[model samples]
Target chain A: MSELLIATHGLTKVYRGGVTAVDHVDLEVRAGDVYGFLGANGSGKTTTVRMLLGLVLATEGGIELFGEAMPKAGASVLPRVGALVEGPGAYPHLSGRANLTLLDSTDGRRRRGDRRRRVGEVLEQVGLDPADRRPVRTYSLGMRQRLGLASALLRRPPLLVLDEPTNGLDPQGIREMRELLLSLNRAGTTIFLSSHLLAEIEQMSSRVGVLDRGRLVLQEDLATLQAPTGLVRVRTPDLSTALRLLDGQVVDRGEGHLVVRSPDAAALNAHLVARDVRVTELGPERRSLEEIVLAASESA
Target chain B: MIRVELVKLLTRPRTWITILALNALPTLVAVLLAVTDLGPRPGTGPPFLSAVLTDGTLFPLAALGIVLPLFLPVAVAVVGGDAIAGEVQSDTLRYLLVRPVSRLRLLVAKLVSVVVFVVLAVLAVAVVAYVEGRLLLGDAPATGVVSVSGSTLTQAEMTQRTGLAFVYVVLAMLGVAAIALFFSTLTDSAVGAALGTIGVLVASTVLLGLDAADAIKPYLMTRHWLAFVDLFRDPIRWGDVVDGVLTQLGYLVVFAGAAWANFATKDVNR
Candidate 1:
């Protein structure tokens, strides 16, 4: 991966009425790496993204983009960064082509042939047909997502920040978006994707950061974080006593059940037997990305 | 792609539609009035048409006396008042800001578009009213029916009066539109901005009506709203016209300056 493309230290945002949505978040995203920012709704992921793009004012701290300190948005830095902060921002009354024309003209990158050519390229990249000139309001949710993606790709920006780009997409559209993002990353563009869907992030991102309640709990590569490990669920006659004995080794699974992870099952059974807890059911549990994420979230 | 900011401006179809209706209504009403014989004829004057249209009385009703003072500026406000705040409500403002454009440029583009719409709407009202007046009342000589109070001017004088009235109305309308645009910056609800603008205009008009408050009337925006009234008198007074232009210009500068500052600094999270 290239050097750090984005770095922030002590970033914070406090809304009115004393709600501290984002609390002193520090993040580092390297160039050409697909970094997934994971968090549930209202967990400060969106707030941090907004601060980085200068859409919302940061309460405190420093942000550096591509090696330069960013006290505020600057012309030198912003033009090279493309983002879809929330959702589709295009005009509903204008056709998809007209929307692209407006964005292209603002940057003074104009040429009749270039406009048509670039629009075609971006439409193809986003899986939208350039020949269709219907207003964006008529597009489906997935199509709007594609249109937004096309807008972001118009400039072929080096740093692309997309928040929930695959939101509301069908399985096919989601797969296409995943592939498109990977292709963009392969071409040396750093991708910063914020989403609540860990499965999608697990499939696409090189690294993932888990945020819970306005705080970062863990930041690790997807491969390292998803290492397969067996989870052992043993049902006993006495649930309360089993949990008491294996205090630090148990994840609360409500309704008088506990999930314990261990490599040796025989040894676990012997220990439980010694405590007079009957093991009714003992089996190896498969650990999926969803379980791991849930465990991490529950632990946080 | 046209700039995202401009696209945002055009997305609200209701804004311009409201402006179109507001501008067209005054002319429509005037035309309807011209064709009808609602009021009594003066001194059994040859029918209502000869007294009102042919004698040039339609000039005051069409341009200065009523249409410009009440309707034109209010129409301008109806559109310009919702320019900024409407975006906040629709949540599209966030999308535009995320694009590479600065807040200042975005505000400038949106403000210019709103001003352009207001100007165009005002002009439409003026043209339609003028053409309709001329067609309905062409060349017929004035009879003794309509009250040509001693205060009434000659036919030629009335035509000049109408022309000057149009200029003053334009100036007053410009001031109203600027105020409305400023209020739009202060709020997120389109209704709040539009109603607040109209309410302020109405309040100023009421302020001008108070006999005891005459001293403060000269400084009020509403008092100067009828500065076009000066155009109706003989030997047209350029002093009120100049003061009216300068005052409207001053208000425009202040309102526009505040809008720029607020939009540039305010957080557009939407």
Candidate 2:
């Protein structure tokens, strides 16, 4: 297995009013892995990322980046990491290129040509025109997002953390982002991303963690999380009586449909028919990530 | 590190425009006084030049008061204001913090940049004032400091006094710069940093002005801010300048430390 590039052990955070913003969350992200952090609004995803970055102090817990303790890791760990948090905050009054040029190696020693060349490369990678000199304020939301990504890529760090990277992108922009992330991972960069968009997570992530009410409700490989939950949707003439007669646990009993968790579909059908309920159809329900996540959160 | 900050500073048009306007304001005042022939006759030494220089120092010092009240603080605010708050507001603090750089380095880089600008503004004022003083008062030097206690100095002493007076004024401005910088750490909005700095300065000035109110006078930063004017005295009472520099240093250290501590502890998530 690849090394765990980023890890958080029993992380907890409490804001003013003793609100548990994050509570005892354990997260492990492996190198070269695209880890998807999925959570609803107010689920502590951002809080977790902030802790990992050392932007905010953790109330209790430790975080490790590349096997070294953080944020005590200091400048030693950050040099190898790049991130785009919350929104794409660029210097609105500055040109796109100017924004990217604001941070560099601290010793005032820079190969000017190399810096310029790298900036051009990242801009092109993000699909921004290399020569575009317009102030960032003039750029559209998608363009600004691209500029932000360009800034993150400037130093070519090994690990990249992005929060809601697709928050303000069109369909084409989203596709480009997905492809770009895949390419980055292939190039040996580990990516940890958080998003409320489940479909996007499903499409990009190798592993996923779901946070709910400041707790990690679920963490699993993408394949397992996306696997068919084996929920059977049943439509019967007498839904209420049919649900009562069914051997499986009833998940949903509505006007014309019923959903149940059961492997023995044939046994369920036979039992339902014997109860004078005419079964119209019965098949496995294809659960979307949205449904599974909501169920997990509710259960937690 | 300086280059990165310089690039950031130079790229923003507002930086140049602000410096330009500030430099020009005094020149404009000087030109108006010269054109209106608003001074003592040439052989008699221009009353207008002395009045102009004293108040030029005072007005710009007042403008310095305003600028410190707003401009330097705004500048300091922009630096400290954006220090972490800007990152938080822009959501880029995460990216910057995650990099190999420490919070202290980042804060130091920003503070250094603001100091550079403050230095720039002070130098610009000194140069413009020199040119205006020369043009309005002629190449000859003014008399010694007109002592509040009624004493006079020779011409040679007067020249030294004027030069030293300008230096003290710049030093006094540094006190204002430090205050603005300290306030900048408290807010993200440049406006908040600027306005808060000015508000504090105006209050300090008020406290300093209250003659009989002995309680708060000694502690106020404004109390000794004008002591640079004492450089004009014939004997050059080093006491006031020494006291002023020491007070300014004390405030710089105290305010700067307070800002750093608050910033180091502030949740960047804000």
Candidate 3:
């Protein structure tokens, strides 16, 4: 019930050979929030998650889960956090049901007889057949992903941390995973996941944190980030003069229209009008989430 | 968590396959010896083959000898090396370690599982060899082998020696298992871990051949592997057997410790 389910102070990780995977990242995920971590491949997103989970040692800084200091408290705190990081991490020779049962038995809090029911429930929830006895090695990429999700849900923990839960899923599989995650979040599990799929994050996340290179560049609610990007597509009779007057400002020039982005489109139009530039067509345009993210990453 | 480790170990067809394959050599030896009747004079063929030809009870002993030098130990190496390395290769260590269990605790579970595997493998060799020997070569009258004290022992004494001898073999292989587990913790490649474990043993065996290694030979993990032979000797020569036990214990301690320290500090990037 802590305010922040996860918090980090100056968290950093430097691998051998002097490669810094994560650099002084300070992050917070409040309780009951679906926090999406977005980054390009090899953008230190996985490394940050690993550090938070105590799977990787941090070169500097500290982390806390449920108000307890990490690594030190990870053992005590981990049973309350379910996770699927990067790989299926499943025993290929065991059936899907067998895999979940085996993993569930590891939890100290797992009750007698509750294990089978929990495993069965998770299997059904993940859309896998409860009675399927096929080994995991024979499963398709999507099935393996579902199995991974099933393992994370085995405990029904308060927090579910997944890394690229939709990495290799097909369109339908992706949608299923998205809906499953949304439902889990709705049921009060604070979900923290990382993915390179910006649009997926935009659709599924209530809040998002962006990682570029090795640093956390931006963290904001999707509502705030999805705000009308204040982009205005304007065409003027004197295009050259409009360009001059708009110097030192952010602008994108298209074939016919000059794209100007600002918080207020009316003010931009008034300034252009005062400059004696006869505007032909002016309309406010909103930027998509992908475009906004692309802009941020490009500038980084 | 240990239960999880056991279930995982048991459900794999590879586990039973490894055990069956390990028993293959002894089974082959039994069938060949029974048919050919070509008695490989004492100390010539295998350590206990001559006895196996005469006494069905000794067939299990002969099987142990065949496997101890190569077969069973290799299986142990495979299983032990695959302990964490297999998980790492499959990227399952990330999931396993994220549970409530600590790295050391997981390592212990894995080590215990490997030990259970070794015990099962050794016992398989013994049981199958016993049945094969009993059916093909035939058992002896409750009489036992002659003791160094120059006295023939009873069935009880022989059975006791057999049990002690098997236990000693398990301990000896614990050295190899620990070594393999250490390498398993060191690498993410399961094949490399298994091969690396076997590679070190092979190198040590090769070293035991050099005249310069005489002083260190006694300390080699491979040196005391056949000490189980001493248990079969008259008067039960405890000297070499005890030394082997101590040497194996020493290796297990050092190597198990090394595996622990390395695994504890390792970053589970895979």
Q: For each candidate, what's the DockQ? A: 0.27, 0.42, 0.65
Candidate order, lDDT descending: 3, 2, 1
Give one digit per residue, the lDDT tens place, for model 3 in B166-195: 899888888888989999999987788889
lDDT of 1 by residue, B1-270 (tens): 224444555566765676556546545555665667343354352222334445444533444344455665666676677666766664456655665566777666766676666555556656655566666544455532222333656667765655666656666666676777778878888778878888888888888889988887766776666556566545566687778788778877887788787777676565
Better of 1 and 3 by lDDT: 3
User: What local lDDT score does residue A82 receive in model 2, on the 0 to 100 scale?
Assistant: 77
Tens digits of per-residue lDDT, candidate 1, A23-48, equal 87888898877999999998988888
Task: For candidate 3, give the lDDT.
Answer: 0.85
**Candidate 1: pairs in clash:** A100-B1, A101-B1, A101-B2, A102-B1, A102-B2, A102-B3, A103-B1, B42-B145, B42-B146, B45-B145
**lDDT of candidate 3 over A1-300, digit per residue (tens):** 449999999998889999989988989899888998999999998899898889999999999999999999987899889898886778887888888778778775668677778888889998898444898889888899889988888778899999999877899989988898898899899999898987788888888888999988888777887777677888877888988888766469876579886778889989999989999888777666787777787887
* Model 2: CA > 4 A from native: A105-113, A228-286, B40-92, B134-163
Relative to the true structure, candidate 1 has a C-alpha RMSD (angstroms) of 7.2
- Return the interface RMSD of the candidates, in order shown, one decimal each: 3.0, 2.6, 1.2
Docking class of 2: acceptable
What are the models' TM-scores? 0.80, 0.82, 0.90
Sort all candidates by DockQ, best to worst: 3, 2, 1
Which candidate would rank higher by DockQ, 2 or 3? 3
Provide the lDDT at A137 for model 3. 85
